[model samples]
Target: MAPISIRNNPDRLRYEVLDGDLAIGQAAYVDDGEGRRIFYHTVIDEDYGGQGLAGRLAAQALDETVAAGLMIVPVCPYIKNYLGKHTQYADNIQKPTPALLTVLNNALARRTRR
Candidate 1:
């Protein structure tokens, strides 16, 4: 098995989990550039599933976002469900507002077009 690690890839606007040099999972987000990062998607490769990589990814991503003084806006079902059980980040979580939803939708649309 390869060693696993996670890191923020700002250029791609996501937190990626790598097994050695191969990326196996990602928690994608969009920084609204106004104090919040909207996590819109998360996925772990099927081959890498059942290993808790998603939980680890979400934990580190949320940790870094809080450390950076940004609000957490979990729009992805996995992330949203994770947040419901993990209260450590409750203080940093911001309920999704209408405007924030729009921001996320627009960003996702651009990604689809590209």
Candidate 2:
């Protein structure tokens, strides 16, 4: 089995899951500059989808968010759902503002249409 490693790539607004030298998944986010991060997308390569990469990605990302003393605005459904199951990360979650909610909804809709 290939070993997977997780790393934050803030320059690209995402946390990546690396399988050796290959990137197999990512969870994308935007820093709101108000000490909060809005997670917007979580994706795994189709070939890598069933291997629990998304869970690993979510865990690392949320754990780092807490470590950074930042709150989470889970704009992405995958993240919202992940947090639901985990709950341990609940203390860091923040409700999004109306404007931010609109933006996130639009993003999700756009992806669904694609």
Candidate 3:
């Protein structure tokens, strides 16, 4: 099996999951510019689904966000779900403000193509 790689794609506001040069999944987020990031989506191609990549994506996304000294506002069900099962990242989690919720929802709406 090829090793999986994940990294932030700032221009796209996503943490891209790569499998040996193949783009397999992504964890999407929006930065609030106030030292917090609102993560709203975690998706893997159906072909890649069921392989636990989504969990890896969530971990790496949260890990990178923490490394950047930012907090997390989980607006995505997938991410929220992931965090629920991983208490270690609880320190970085925060409740989203109404304004942040609006921004998160709109960013999610824009990703309909995904």
- Candidate that scores best on lDDT: 1
lDDT (tens digit, per residue) of candidate 3 on 42-102 = 8898987788889888988898899999999998899988899999989999988899898
Q: After superposition, how far is residue 68 of candidate 2 from its true place, in Å?
A: 0.3
Runs of candidate 3 exceeding 4 Å displacement: 105-114
Deviation (Å) of 102 in candidate 2: 6.4
Query: 31-92 in candidate 1: lDDT tens per residue?
Result: 99999999989999999999999999999999999999999998899999999999988899
Better of 1 and 2 by lDDT: 1
Q: Residue 47 in model 2: shift from native, Å?
A: 0.3
Candidate 3: count of backbone clashes, pairs at least 3 residues apart or interchain: 0
Query: Residue by residue across 11-82, what tens digits does model 2's lDDT show?
Result: 677999998978888999877667888898899999887878898899999999999999999878999999
Clashes by residue pair, model 1: none
Q: TM-scores for all candidates?
A: 0.94, 0.84, 0.85
Question: Would you list the rank order by TM-score, best first?
Answer: 1, 3, 2
Model 2 global lDDT (CA atoms, 0 to 1): 0.86
Pull out the clashing pairs in model 3. Answer: none
Model 3 whole-model lDDT (C-alpha atoms): 0.87
Specify the highest-TM-score model's number: 1
Which one wins by lDDT: 2 or 3?
A: 3
- The CA lDDT of each predicted structure is 0.94, 0.86, 0.87
